[model samples]
Target: MAILKHFAVKNADYGAVIDYLKYQHDEFHLVPILDENGNSMLRDEFYFDGLNCNPEAFDLECELLNQQYHKNQRYDEIKCHHYIISHDPMDVADHGLTGEQAQAIGMEYAKANFPGHQALVCTHTDGSNNSGNIHTHIIINSLRKEDIASQLYTERAIDCKAGYKHHLTKEYLRHLQGSLMDICQREGLYQVDLLSPAAEKITQQEYHAQRRGQLNLDMANMEIMAEGIAPMKTKFETNKEKIRNAINDIAERAKSFEEFQRLLKAEYGIQVKDHRGRFSYLPSDRQKFISARKLGSHYDREYLLQLFEENALAAEQNQAQWVQDDPITILFIKSDLRLVVDLQNCIKAQQSRAYAQKVKISNLQQMAKTVAYIQEHGYDTQEKLQDTTDTIQSKMAKARSDAKLTEAKLKRVNEQIHYLGQYLSTKSVYADFLKSTNKKDSRQNHADEIAKYEEALQFLKQHSPDGKLPTMNDLRSEKELLVQQKSAQYETYQYFRDYHRELQTVCENVNHILDISQPKQQEQKRLHQSEHSL
Candidate 1:
């Protein structure tokens, strides 16, 4: 799925943009990584070209153009528009996309969109996420150099004239996405819907927050695991996710809309308010409420009301077969992918960085290992491969479900042990308070212990239901077994998940090879043509 992203550079040093595009930089520290010789580290693999200017003299040429046009003179003015078109990783893995081809595509796009602008187009093989996605960078000087005929998505007549500044409108961005969709169709590459709102949209801010939070949590977890303790949380949930979980919890349990509101406030401190026929949620931390429209259609007022009605109906019609015990699962974890038939012809010639190019070839060779894996697993046909994938996926699902169940049991055991220990330690104080002739004085002296004893007692009784206190040793034994079981189940789940991913990739590639049905891609192409035609 290729998507268009844009940024405006306020600084006049157009050289920095080209430099960053060609070198390695530390994203975490926001600095350039110098080599042992104290020079900027060159990027591993890239394809670069300039439009209406020399690649080596891009910075000088852009400055001269701006001087000639007397544009982008102010310190705060946007000097250049940086546009990124990131192609799907699957395009490289299956559809044979390469940096050189992507660069050519980006050059064509830049010419078509910003016809009279001096631009630099560069393509790189390695994304920051190491996703192996082919992406192109198109940086156009805000000052145009030559006049051109008016094209599609141009909002104003001045937009096509020389000496005029480049203007990016929302309509132009939509048209860019449409062009990408067309490219994907013509090349038979995978594409995603770029026209409409995603069913679940995470704002750019939330996405970055999640990434940083997950990074911090991972470091914390490493320290925790080094101490030989299993970290309580392996994933970090954002504020929006917390709200979603809170809503889901209350949604499942509450019998009515009124009950739902009460439960949300009581349990999660999330206030759901309705105004002008729309629902908004104000979490405890936020000053302003977030609308359901931002959250998703699932959390909309109409959808939630329908969910509430369905839940009520389900409770009234609860049948014996409505719920069933999960079948037991045995868990385990794979390796392999296929090499492209001809890699040399697609990618740029490996001349400058032999070691880096070798690394890429190594990855290709690693992908070749999949052929041996397929034969070893006796996956002679695509059907066999798909069937095995489905079976492993089922096992993975069962493993995850069982692991969660074990975790719940472990939590209960831990809670029981804590309360029981507290109750035992405070039992003598409470007993003495009861026996004292001046009960008021004794209660005052032992207030803390008495309070602790009663709180523990209440919790134990509620959890027990039958009002029976299980032995400490029994609880301890259960906790020990649960810890081991949880560890095993987690390992099993991870194993099956990796296995499923590897096998699924192979299945998808096979499907691609045989030109199997892809209705979604066809539909996307059809829509692009119908809607984007001038």
Candidate 2:
């Protein structure tokens, strides 16, 4: 899977980014020893190019732009936005991806996204764990250097104008992710669901921490082995990994939120608390609690609780057990969600004269509004009103269902497009393998490539049972149609959700009226007493 990551570079030195891309910084940290006949050296398997600027003098060009725009002057101002697209390690073997190709892709992406900004595009094959993954680095000056045309990703007018500093928003990042996915699909590379959270999310910091820790542990293990002793612990695990394991361990077996919490505390020395509708966990070694937001969605409150409810009937049911089980009791105890309110039970309204009068006036006005609404909507009966609410809720739920289905169709189309590209691009390799007399050696040399060809062929064949595989244009056009339909369905879902909320509030108000609005004589006596008291 190709993952897209972002970083905001606030340092004033734009040359440092290019330097990091072009040279090795592992041990010497750019302290270079000149070769006999050369001034400097560049790293192996590294390709770099610039857009709207000279690659050799990116910093100077950016500085000139900054001066012209009068932006990025403050010390704390962000000078550049760094985006990295890391392809899956498997892409190298399966797709025969190269550094040059990745660099070209990065150049195209940067030129399309950051058109007005002076940008440097770099590709590396032997950096960041030496994982044999081809990744690209896209670094763009924060200030716009030209007044370029706007794109669908552009959110504001200033984004396309010169002299304005780049300020990326969440929407822009999501669009970039979508664009990255599209690029990966078109390029016949692996792609992940960037729109959703990962099952196990390791941040860049945590990833590097684990990498360094593992490296150090391997070194220590080597020394121990040199002494003819087997190291007891050869593997290293980060604190977050331990926490995640503990939480998943407890949540997989526990039946309720409380039981899960108790087991988590007793078994792992981890304390879990629901704070302001969210869960926060404190490990034994940490002073502060880490929010579930930092962790992936698999550890969040909604997911865990739902998992527990499903685990409750593990001994009996097979699928969606919670759907059959009643959650009303649990919700009434733990959740603020409710169907109705009891206005008569408000003790504060009964305690004071002025407050009582104010509440009564408000309740009378609400009751009048409720009546007017019921009459206006022709809901003359309680059952009819409730039926209307249920119908609207059902419609909202159906709209959401439609949106999910449409999104899934879009994803399928994306996969079909990817496999179609793979099928077409690898036909020559397959033909050569078939024609080669030394078939065994050829297959052994390109095992992953062979697998890629076979898997893509099988997938396309199955997807197109009629044996008429779709062309790239057909798949892309289908994707475009699905995207438009998905958006329309999402808008419909939003409209229904808003309408449901409005109707639900009216229904709750009607219930409140039912609770507080009493007989005329008794209500008059209560108001008369409150008037005298006031």
Candidate 3:
């Protein structure tokens, strides 16, 4: 599966990005590099276009634009944007797409997405810690090539164009992601959800930290190899994971917001603060507070509150049947919630695999049935078998069409569910902001939080104007129904696909047998005719 990571470079030299993509020396290596990963720091796969000049002279091209249009522009203005398109290592290896092919894909994507921009695309084979992930790097200048007058300009200039500046909004990013997924599907490559559920989302910082920690462990193993000593095993967790675990612990035991805050501070040394409407966590060791949303959906304020409510209700219902547990026991129970979530995910994945297996088995059985039917009905002639094959082909085509329609529907429904989920989860924050009386301080101190809440509220109002938000349960049920519909469509498509292939095979075998028997049948006819004449 492919994932995208991007950032805009402000006041940064384009040459630096080029150099990093082309050169091999790591002057400041943050992670250990394995020897087997090879010394070829840069893969020999790069592509570029739309510069109207040599790519090697891209820096000059950008500079010329700046000179022509914005010579007095601020030094801190964004000059370039760098995007990384990375694929899973196993998927890339299995697909066997060469680095050049990857580069071509990246180039096409960049050219299509960032039209009129000077861009260079490069494919890299060596990932962090020698992970062997194939990824592409696309660097494009931020300056507009066409001339136009806009609010930011008094007159049309060489480097300024109306609506040329890239807007890296959430909606825009989601569109790009969907486009990438479509490209992968067209290319018959494996892909996961680009816009995955919030629960499964992992920030880039957390991902890199986990990778770095793994590399550290790898380095320690290398040392053990050199010393000929027993290897030490130590479990490492990312900071986000640790925070998530801590939050889960507190949410499971506390019944109210105040209790939740008190227990978190007393038991975990973590401070929970509600700024305006958004909730953030500050660890005792850390001075900065991180937003709960950054951790995961489960740790988000609304979800945590929902869990507390559910726990309280369960306790009330089973008070006589339940026994009070100590803090340690409670901790163990809270930890089990994480395990349960993980187990549920595992079950879903297994169910998908089982469905696929069932499809394959059903196809085999149908193939066997087809063969038996052909023998029983004496479909010995090529014409009869050909007619049957054509019928099956028509059915297969219809199934494919149905599957495509179902997939499109599923995509739309899933997207709706995602946004609805986001709005519902952040609705409480928006409500809190509305009820707060210290508007001045709230706006000044909790600017980011307020902005997020307002954004969610705006999106909900725009998309769902009735001011009614679907409950989590309703969304989940809808999601499950859509998933089942998609799965059934997929199964139908696969069944016909496999049946068609098997029928073709059988037709070929039957044709070959008829070819061998034709001469003998002809000779027998001549012999019988001669005997009748005698």
lDDT per residue for candidate 1 within 245-269, as digits (tens), equals 8888888877777778876875566
Q: What's the CA RMSD of model 2 in angstroms?
A: 28.6
List per-prediction Cα lDDT, in the order shown: 0.80, 0.80, 0.67
The TM-scores of all predictions, comma-separated, are 0.55, 0.56, 0.49
Evaluate residue 26 in candidate 3 and report its C-alpha lDDT on the 0 to 100 scale.
46
Best model number under TM-score: 2
Instruction: Write the number of the candidate with greater TM-score, choosing between 1 and 2.
Output: 2
lDDT of 3: 0.67
Better of 1 and 3 by TM-score: 1
Tens digits of per-residue lDDT for model 2 on 304-338? 88898888877456434533453221121121223
* Candidate 2 residue pairs in clash (backbone atoms < 3 Å): none
